[model samples]
Target: MRHFIAVSAIALAAGSAGAQEIAQADSDWYKAGQERIQAELAKTQNTNKARNVILFVADGNGVASNYMNRLYAGQMEGGMGDDYVQPQEAFPYLALVKTYNINAQTPDSAPTAGAMNTGVKQRFNLINLGENAIHGDCAKVSGNELTLFSELMTEAGKSVGAVTTARLTHATPAAVYAKTANRNWEDSVPEGCTAQADIATQMIDAMEAGTLDVALGGGARYFVPKGMGTPNGGTGHRPDDVNLIDRAKGLGIQFVHDKAGLDAAADNAPILGFWSDSHASYEADRPETEPSLADMTAKAIEALSTNENGFYLEIEAGRVDHANHATNAKRAMIDGKAFADAVALADEMTDDADTLIIVTADHEHAVAMNGYCGRGTPIDGLCFDVAKQGIEHSDELVLADDGKPFTVVGYLNGASSVMVKQDDGRFTAPDGRPEITQEQAQDLDYNQQVLIPKDSESHSGVDVALYAKGPWAHLFDGTIEQNVIFHVMNYATNAN
Candidate 1:
């Protein structure tokens, strides 16, 4: 019995010693891993320490659009010389991201942007909240609560800013700060929600909370009082309502309305610049009514870069989607180029090795650049004029050969069949007659007003491309889920 007890004690001591050795080995492995990470982090130049993160969102932009833009900018038409190759060619880090909503195969800006901002998949038409949240009721949602901007700036002590060619309260921008199930809560109230918070309320709250350092873009009417003429000569917000400009002032926000005002504002001060009452005009159609996307981006970087703690700025070129929906190829391409120009500017301004810059799209459009429209010969056999062809504005009406009165393009589902037009004023279909204007083709007696084409263009379901530069850019190598973007940004910014 004594021998047996001694044997048992010996075995227990041996087991305890082995356990202690294993624990020590694990501790050593952990220390080694941490040291390796620290060494890697130390090798990065302080200039590349990422004092600022700039995310440029080209709304509805896709791989096709990027290729198209490259073609246009390079003037690479018909195997032309590569003299026009832009600097985007050298972008080494690229990834493809999935962009589907929880409820829809072809996602809209609401949920797609929500996924990008909140790092969570959400239902269609919802912004910044999970699928189960009651529309416009932030109280119902649980578990999925961390917003990239809120998490980075509030918890991680980074500054946050947003700039867009669309309204600042629009889906893409709102996803960063506002929490609502329905994205359309700006103009209409959602079911089961008591507080119908507009873009103005979100902006004010962000400003008052002292997290949002810069807010620039359109949506002037939401900020102004009623009876006052908006920046676009439209009636402003309701009279007797709280003035957002004053509210911004109370929160120590430096409000600016025009380009000069924006330029004059101190870089250190928080800025609220609203250039238009609604969305800024497309880059192709801007006629004193809007600021270019590039301009907004440059201004935003200048304003946000002054922070010592680093800043997170979101710049959105939002009108490309609108043009794509209208099926206006020229407008879409031009707007996309304008957005790209903004990215170029950002690349130049934030070239510091530590600044992380990401360029991507929320979704893609159904627009495709098919093969060559013109014949082989440039002069004689070329039946279509590439430059002069104007698209039929609507698909409802058709133009007569004599250019006298409008007729029907064709009939589809009891609606007039619409045809897309090229730049040379030639229609796509062989039987499609030339109309006086594209709008004439669109104006038809139908159930829905076919804006560009009779049925309207749709968004593509393909994954979109993501381009990255600066610190940790190598991390964006493989195709990834949409939510992984948050993790990348979280890691890049060193957000805990």
Candidate 2:
């Protein structure tokens, strides 16, 4: 029940001109909230002593997604129940994180994830290379610089690992290991650039250096040959006939492509598992195609925990951001719940006293929950009242032109009555009924369609929540900058 707010000086300065007017409008509420935040921060005490750290990034997750997941879970349990039934509710320590890039009004994943991974603020597209990154030439950037994972592993003699649903070369995952000027230069050369250091190359380097123990999740395409079919039959290729899997094997790293392969690999061998070419599918969508995030987390822990020195692992639920970008609240919530499930699994597998677990998001999406639709609302409930003829529901719900419900989520930019069924096995909005759809929803233009002022279903400048458990959890009370996560993890792992 303790709440805290930490607004930046920039926000405060921006509001100063109109501060008197706003104070007159909501003076009591604002002052009360501020007082409450201060009191909460003052009462917080740091007493945790963690030896290992596991960080989970629910890419674009925000406060709204957290609450919505709780509400959906509560509704599933007959409503008015505790939101704690959702996995995130189990964490005892929480904080608010300020997510903003050094240069952009709206931040991207590169710098946002980099801030958490390195504890330094850099230009928007620069990864772990830090602020010294040149716009076009990433090779010139000094990347051997310390990452939280690298620093921890070196200081504690612990192993390090990174897992994600997206390509291991993607921004979130790469921030933990690879450094580059641009995020999109996965395995490909950057435009007009000579040196190319994709995430796969970095993983191999880490493996060779004996610092990284586990590297899991998609982007087999960057590790294998083009002719070879990916784990999913798609092409998995590297440009120079460089089979990263072979390179990993040359370094005595165990490479696995499927669940069975992972299961059969030697327990003590360092692992490099690439299950897909790109991001892995959602649990509900590709239940059989790939391993769930929970499965991957369990495997990573199993592989790393064997080291006598402990380990640092970063697990990302990257698809949650994709779902949010599409304005699919149900999908986002479901995926978010699954991500939390991975955290719970990690909590159970590792000793809470020795393992530090941190759950947070890079940024927030512009998804907001309006008034509730009333209890006992059928799965196929009508989104709007029939009596209000010609009055459309908010543009948040994705409907079909034929009136068949395709998706329950809608976007803020595009106008589409075409309903597309979600691949996930969830409820779907029924025609003319206020029902939720089984398919994920899309983001819509809140301004043009719903008369809401948001331009696109874009990332918000609002603060995000950080939930932690295990040792050092108490340090997370109150509000802090997104980069503080690196310091917390470093402290927990005894990394300098």
Candidate 3:
């Protein structure tokens, strides 16, 4: 539990003169502080049963990534970005979640998301399976399958849905219903692993069994047989002749391939939409043929709300992870903003009294924000010199030890290394950091400089932030194990 001290009371306790001075100070900052404290003090926790749950996950969105996104979003709105408030940041309850897998320190999306969905820490690269299950061995997975919140919600008569910017069979979203020993078994498994079904097959099985009411995302190829052409100008990836797209249609699921199809989908029918052959385009590069994260969120809510038992939906901005891995800060921040927009739309669509909305990340990335740059510095551009007088930035740019300007945002290790690969296949460091101009650094295609050389940046073993509101939200306070999120959701809905 936490307690708050009134602003005036604290000042008066200091001294009468100090209290009078503080009260007389009518600056906007002072007034804003007082008003915020009052709002906090007046807030009352909702203890009712959570009729609905919407888990909004931004994959690889760690604390540092979130800070960078905030500044970028604020600057995009024509303001100094530090003070900008994202929609989830305004939630009444928050907690720092320790994201570690049972077998690994720095976790990947599979076990981390599995922890949230199944209420237990799991092995690396595994989906909703018990710790005893081997990563790719199917023989040990039979009784070790863990129950996910999606299953529980469906059993309780609630409508269940999942939407992501990544493939529906991707690790994070697959945790919603999949029970597999390996995350990579999306459309096919390795040789000799015949006992365990692929993730896409499991999802379709759930939908066929009436467990999943809505499914939308990018991996159209996984659902169709090889040699089959998709609406996105790409062919399918499945090795077998099983065309899951046709099977979905035969099951009476409303299948949509483009934004137009999604728009015309029947209001009361089950929906399965695939907007891209692979992961959807980064929010900044999205085309008119595809819907935004917010659009998918709105459609999911509308389709599920008709159920009297309410719904459980998981919405993931999975492209943020891809951008971070490639050290593309611009696309990462844009996708993050798109995620915030989806959260805002979901909040507006449901009543807080009956809905439990949780906004969090499955894991943090190695991307970091560096330098003591001045206020209003372009988050995706080079760091600038600080202004000594006011909130505005100085005209000069900050230079690195190499006498060249560096970006405000960069990855700890990624594709943009100073070392170059030679014809002999040896990576050799040439000279110092490359000369980076502000215009070049701010380009949409820019890859931020990295210290270590790797094909892709890695996930960081750090605590990610979780923001929640509505029923039982107060239970999420201070620091907690990532798996506790599942327990909190379970208790909130079942306790009543």
My TM-score estimates for the predictions, one after another, are 0.73, 0.76, 0.96
lDDT tens digits by residue: candidate 3, 1-496: 1235576566644543464456555777776866786788889989999999999999999899999888888988999999999999999999999999999999999999999999999999999899899988888888898988988998999999999999999999899989899899999987777677899999999998777889999999998889999767899999988989889989999999888898888768799999999999999999998999999999999999989899999999999999999999999999999999999999999999999999999989998787879989999998998999988889889988879889999888988987778789987776767899999999999999998899998989999999999999999999999999999999888866
For model 2, give the RMSD to the true fold. Answer: 10.4
lDDT of 2 by residue, 132-164 (tens): 666557566654344555655756778888889
Cα-based lDDT for every prediction: 0.66, 0.69, 0.91
| Candidate 1 Cα errors over 4 Å, as ranges | 1-49, 76-89, 134-146, 187-192, 237-240, 288-290, 372-456
How much RMSD separates candidate 3 from the native structure? Answer: 2.8
Better of 1 and 3 by TM-score: 3
TM-score of candidate 2 relative to the true fold: 0.76
Report the Cα lDDT for residue 307, model 2. 81
Model 3 per-residue lDDT at 340: 94
User: Model 1 scores what on Cα lDDT?
Assistant: 0.66
Q: How would the candidate models be sorted by lDDT, starting from the highest?
A: 3, 2, 1
Q: What is the lDDT of candidate 3?
A: 0.91
